[model samples]
Target: MESMLIEKSIQGDVASFEQLIVKYNRYVYNIAFRMMGNEEDAKDMSQEALIKAFKAIGQFKREANFSTWLYRITINVCKDEMRKRKEHVLSYDVENQDEGSMKENIKDESTNPILIYEQLELKETIETALNKLSEDSKAVVVLKDLLGYSYEEIGTILDIPVGTVRSRLNRSRSALKSILQVQLAEQ
Candidate 1:
């Protein structure tokens, strides 16, 4: 179904292109949101990625999964945006943030104030540590750990070697561990 749509879209069928957008828009936006940590930037990046993909549709060879190709485009768009922002912090829109998987592990029957406070503190610390990583390392961490992509897939997405993916992930994890330990000690 997707191949047919891609073929049609590449042939300049506007409806086919719209169908492609409708199908993958949320997927693209979610990836952007994870990398960007905010809805506004996610929306902007996803829109830009889709436009770029559409413009370059003729060049897409269809060897890789469409989703993977789209993901690469999204990552590049986000990285470009990050460069423009020139900030070390993720915007981290609280209003748009989800509880995420971390919440499930920290949840229990009792909603004690102290526990809640500690959990919030832990979340902030981790977010801060993540935001502090270099953009390439942060992207590796997000893609591998948060998004569950294999090292090989991440290599393809980020256009790096699998060895590089493994090394970057290791470095990122080590950095996170160090940062979290220091943060915990400071508390």
Candidate 2:
């Protein structure tokens, strides 16, 4: 079914392409959100990536998975957006905003309240720590850990060697673990 959509979309069928986008929209947005750490930027990047993919459809080879191809486009869009944002250097109130949300989520919980609170807190801590990582590191972490792409699949999506993917993923995980451990200690 996906292969047929890819074939039809590549043949200049606009509706086919639109259908593909609608089908994978959540997946694309999630990748964007994970990479950018914000909803607005993620939406923008996802749209930008889709536009590029539409234009470049002719160049896509059927040998690889369509989702992998889309992943590459999304990652490139995120890299470009990050580059532009680096020039602005705006500081976000990540800590305070997350803490309030964490409290609210934990407060209304009824079952396994302690464990649920700890889990929510940990998720926020990881998100905060992830935001601190460089864009490249964040992409690797998002694709490997959050998205659960296999090592080979991630390597294909990111256009890196499997060994390189493994190394970067290990480094990203190590960095996050260290940062979260420090945050937990401070609490």
Highest lDDT: which candidate?
2
Estimate, for each residue in 1-187, the C-alpha lDDT of model 2 and write its tens digit: 7778878988989898998888678889999988888899889999999989988988989898888999899998998888888966333323323445454554464543324347878888888878877777788889888989999998998899999999888877766655555455556
Task: Please give the clash total of every predicted structure, in order.
Answer: 0, 0
- Please give the CA lDDT of all the candidate structures: 0.76, 0.79
Summing lDDT over every window of 10 consecutive residues in candidate 1, give the lowest-scoring window: 91-100
lDDT of 1 by residue, 1-104 (tens): 88899999899887898887786788788778777777888898999999899988888878987877888999899889888886655532222334253344
User: What would you estimate as the lDDT of candidate 2?
Assistant: 0.79
Candidate 2 all-Cα RMSD: 7.7
Those runs of model 1 whose alpha carbons end farther than 4 Å from true positions after fitting are 21-23, 87-124, 185-187
lDDT of 1 at 107: 46
